[model samples]
Target chain A: MLPLRVKSMPADRKGIRVDLQLVADMIEPGTRVLDVGCGDGTLLDYLVHFRQVDGRGLELSPDGVHACISAGLPVIQGDADTDLKDYPDDAYDYVVLSQTLQAMYAPKAVLTHLLRIGRRAIISFPNFAYWRVRLYLFLWGRMPRNETLPYTWYETPNIHFCSILDFLELCREMGIVIERSHVLDSWGVPRMMGRSRFLANLFGVQAVFLLRKSG
Target chain B: MGVTERKSTGQAPTSLDGTGPIPGYHVRLGCDSPLRLDCGVELFDFPTAYQTYGRLNADKSNAVLVCHALTGDQFVADAHPVTGKPGWWEMMVGAGKVLDTDRFYVICANILGGCMGTIGPREVNPATGKAWGLSFPVITIADMVRAQAMLIDHLGIDRLFAVVGGSLGGMQVLEWAASYPQRLYTAIPIATALLHTAQNIAFHEVGRQAIMADPDWCGGDYLDQGKRPLRGLAVARMAAHITYLSESALHQKFGRKLQDRKAFTYGFDADFQVESYLRYQGSIFVDRFDANSYLYITRAMDYFDLVESHGGPTKLFRNTPVRFCIVSFTGDWLYPTPENQKIVHALNAVAANVSFAEVVSDKGHDAFLLDEPDFHRVLTGFISGAWERRQGHAAAQG
Candidate 1:
């Protein structure tokens, strides 16, 4: 497994309209998508309905599969860390791993799998090193208890946590080009998505990276 | 007990020392009731069962109830009792998956008129100590929905995150929205329609008639005689199963091809592979499902006309607030895309935030349950997006 290209979502931001807007722009009519770790197939369903994007997903849950199936969607019972290797090279236009990277045992391997199977990959994850999380750890010594990461340490599923700078550096080292990016706060507000990268790294916690596979 | 008598009791599952293998609630019912048929007859008791998964969150905001289709049980995410198979929707609902057991508290109950664990013709009538076969009130799909509502109420879930299902499950999801809109955050109905068309009813009628025609059906009284209408039920399953698939899928899977042979035998026996396959499907179905229960359940499906029941198509979504995701498959003729489109159109007219997708697949209505990649893409995106929206709102609040 390679080092993960991971970034944390920002803190103290609000507004869901930004994410929807980004999703609307990222996909076009008739584009094919593969959403890895899709929670319940909502975005995939929405994109397909509104943008006419043909989409598929890989989720490890039967409830999600049932929801997907009930929506007449398709999915495979595979994990991002191990199962993604089976997909043929460049089989999809976009392989998306949204809010699922943190749960993986090998985030880099998963990202590489996404890159190998699709032309471009969209990766989204909640930032664990945001200002609020940092404050909690610095002051309380207890694991962060923000709304984004709500579970206790014993039950929490987020394993691989990274900062914005760390993710950008990994992408650069891997020679992967960032085609588009969405830097959102914990509240989902886009503070510096389509603008300056330096400001995004300093303030933006939640980050969405759209990268093209270099290798 | 005699070996024959013990066989009839539906001994406990050997997997978990009678506790059963499951992630949550699991229930099993013996074939105790003599089931009654809508065609004025009866059959001995058949195994009807169900189970529940996930914990009901304290706030109950996480409770989502899943309704199964005809011949489906409450075991949506577990193993089936009689068939010894995994739950029908195990692909979508599980820990760490879309319907994350960690997030939402889920409940799945047997439908009211089902032979499953819920009260139905399969349950023994206390007064007569016999299956209520044929003598049971002819049930409608709405009745099934009503029963599900009762189960939800019993479970203390006031509002459901969503009522989601495909095929017959889809039908119930629609009914839940129309009947109890305020209690739902979302409604996901797949591979179903707003109303059962004349053609759909006619097809169900044909299947019911075929089951009733079986001599062993004994006017729905085969239970007392310890016999089953195996031939009739198998034929019924055969006919109904055909409707579940598209011509293209049939052609791709099993054309006018021969079965395990170089040439046709030219005998009355099954020479074509399709014939043999259908026969096997029919025969295996009889071992698990009861003939009379099939007739009753089909009758219930035929009576599912939400538009007609709601008084008119326009009035149905007049006050609907539940977000909807109605999906249809290109090749599903039984519950065609047009049917789902009608649902989408109605929801749109009512000013609902409804999303719909019609995926192209040759698997027909059953495609909703298969390994279709496009299907998962839309679903995974929808559910997680919903969660993200919720999380986003929380983040903005404080």
Candidate 2:
């Protein structure tokens, strides 16, 4: 019998982005996970190998889906906006949506679906009210273009960009409970904000929140 | 493990033409037992031609059946005995290709109602010892799958590792998952739909009409009359061939360039290279294919409606243990991405383990058979993953 190539975990944990590492920390080991917008499956791969989660992915780009599948990851080419409703209720223990909520056509509907399909949902997104973005827009009176939000106004895919406070307000409106949250600074380092929404919304470049639907 | 005694060693009776013995493993099934088909007909003692690559492992768990498309035979990884050309899927089924014959056992069979050394319209009816021709019972996709199941049972394989194919072959893969879910570990259906669309049936109708309209057809009994309807079969092939390719692929390959001359001859003398290419494709197809078999196979495809026979996607695949991987090509208008996504959505509804990839390619529906790197990578990944998972299960059980 030929020796099959078995994939091993990367030796360096720091190789993953800080926000994704925080998101991974929120998931329980051996849980069923579905990662929407799983580009190249880096986080999902880590979850599967390190956390032993039964992970699947839904990616929009053909290249991302191809890369994931070629690496022996289960992934499908599908849009989160339309394909999420097909999944049955509570089909997975954790459904992770990272850095893609702002680009969605309907973030509220998608959040509703995420909660409906999974027992818990871990979501991350670039904060639109970060200090640098506010400063750039206030200083130039133009749309901000930075490392996180790189695209210009005419070509940006992030149409529904929101701040940390905006996401918390939406979660409150949807009757979703934020079990845990983390705010990240511009260097992809986590900040030690303890439930300070104003400070997090004003200074945090990105945010990760673990959420569940309230009864 | 001792069930290896049933292996056939690729030997069987001569073909219909008696040109020479069929060049692969042949088995005469239903000698004492008859296969009752969906069309209310019993076929007995029929010959099934197939080819196998690699050795079935000791536990008989490494077999991956490769279902062939329309006009494709069991010659999967080797040279075709008739065409003397490379196998249709030579790009994917070789020693180290995507299918990886080195690590997996691959089997491909000429489908029932096919002309490639299989029991079809071209074969003789035992009762009258005459060419069955149009009298052969109309077989459906389920019937084809049933025949394949019998073949698997004959080989003594309790379950296959996977069953994979594209287009018509993909239809067979789906039927396998639906009809005999427990017999295969995983199923990969590429560039296919749950049912034949109305437009699909219309295109098939055109091909069938073209063949029947040929003066030499002689009511499909041309074989018995020692006459071959070459022109009609060629025309049918020409028309059907166009549906397998996209307009952009046609434009890129041939466009409006003159065949050999610098300019048009002011007459219908194969002016455009596309026309000449289609003519050549038509001419070559008739040499190796049987026209009556074409009609029977197309009818089988037209009658294929899994939802009608089984139920809705959820109902059809409810609680199925078979892992599914559905693939589609961007340029495949015949079985577009939406049609393929219907399978994924259906699987998702049941929360069944399924993966899907719409490979970015301009190769059209035939992309599955072409050398598309992304498609190959996807297949390689899915198959290896399925194998690893299966091994993991076996280890846990042991």
Candidate 3:
């Protein structure tokens, strides 16, 4: 049979968002990876092309699932909240969930499943305790809405919104090891807040963490 | 492998049996070795009518077997001989289409208990020299797959590139994956479930009862008795047709509007447009379908319980290497998204490589057959990807 031509890669290697690029950086080349809540498969395509990873995706929306599959990415139409448990233990080298943890009904349960399914879990989410968000809620006495958190209380999918400190405490309680971490400013650039959890939680607009099960 | 000899009896003269001129390719399989069916009956010297599109490459890895639905025939991308209409899945099977005959060798066969040329209740039984009718051994979905496996074997192809279908065809796809996992590289079961629900069986029962209640049915021997239970079969088709569509689709296609007249007719003479439409659908269906074949096929579907036969849902696909793409549509009430998802979950539990998509459609259970762009795109992407992966595996082995 004639060899079919593979699709050409996107010209821009740095086209993905900074947070996603950070998540991509943590993944080792040619390892099995699953991206939970993989909307449009931007991160997955990047990982497959650049990192040479065998990537799979789980997306909730029908539109998102179709879009991912249409781009030739293997994606399932499923909710991360309920679908993650179906994966076998350590099925992937890395499991990535970006910007979707706060919207989960049970963020802790999802995190547990993520860590169980992959050797390591990479998660990124907006920090509700960021100074600007805290100030906006303090000044207006209303649910803070910004570019990162772009919805009102009733309309928001971010039901279980949490601060960076809250997430760190939960990880500690669950006996999860924080392998590496990054605190991003509003522009999605990593801020230099080494060894200072208080300043990171107080100022970082978003946080990304690489975690693994405690020994 | 050498039990049955492969020979194509190309275009034999119209036989004395009630079935008309043979169409397309017909092969007489299991002549020396009979096919042992689920019902403990062995079928020998059975004929399988099939059609092929594109060309099988030298390595023969591009062959894709498309399983047709209950009423569908082997005419995957061509015009039907009897109906003169386009093939059922023409939208998804031609050049540049989702199945893309240009790149893939596509094959479809008339299923075991189907009326379109394949051996069914309408065919003559060699022992009795008459139509089998109700005497035809009760077959199941497994029986259908067993027959298809025979055809694939006779064609000199060991492993098919893919086996794809929707609805009952989808059930056959699942059966293929379960019973012959090593024979196919990828499986695409769209708008189907691992087993038939009680509601599904109930609907089939209604259609069966409608056919049996007809005075002209002659206890399933209508063919030999010089009588055709057209009305009974038409009613059965009409009732079964409703289940294949969504309530919203019905409403959208034919509301409370009257047929041919602005006002409703007091007498029961197909006044509503919906009534007339269904009546027309029923009337045309009997022209191409067989009453006894309908009964046997529906019974086969009703008896399909993968969990019962395969131990359990998750157990059915344990350690399978075949890639799966399970597709469901939002408006398909017959086999809803949740039912399809159960198959995904089962595959997931076994760590089988599977992709699933529930395409958004208001067209109901028939959405898989209709012109849904999203559905088309998903199929295109999946087939192309699976092809690429198959190539990758082949190259790696080399």
**Number of backbone-clashing residue pairs for each candidate, in the order shown:** 60, 1, 0
User: How many clashing pairs in candidate 2?
Assistant: 1
Residue B17 error, candidate 3, Å? 12
Against the reference, the lDDT scores of all candidates come to 0.70, 0.86, 0.87
Score candidate 3 by DockQ. 0.63
Every candidate's DockQ is: 0.02, 0.67, 0.63
Clashing pairs in 2: B10-B25
CA shift of A179, model 3, Å:
1.6
Model 2, A81-150: lDDT tens digits are 9999999999999999988898789999999999999999999888889999999999999998877776
Question: Top model by DockQ, which number?
Answer: 2
Docking class of 1: incorrect
Lowest summed lDDT over 10 consecutive residues: which window, candidate 2 chain B?
Answer: B1-10
Could you estimate the TM-score for every candidate? 0.60, 0.94, 0.93
At residue B159, give the lDDT of candidate 1. Answer: 81
Instruction: Estimate candidate 3's alpha-carbon lDDT, on a 0 to 1 scale.
Output: 0.87
Model 1, stretches more than 4 Å misplaced?
Answer: A1-215, B1-49, B390-398
lDDT of each residue in B3-121, candidate 2, tens digit only: 12222344443544556667777777877678899979998878888899988899999999999998998998888776688999989987888888888889999999988777999
Model 1 chain A scores worst on lDDT over the 10 consecutive residues at A1-10
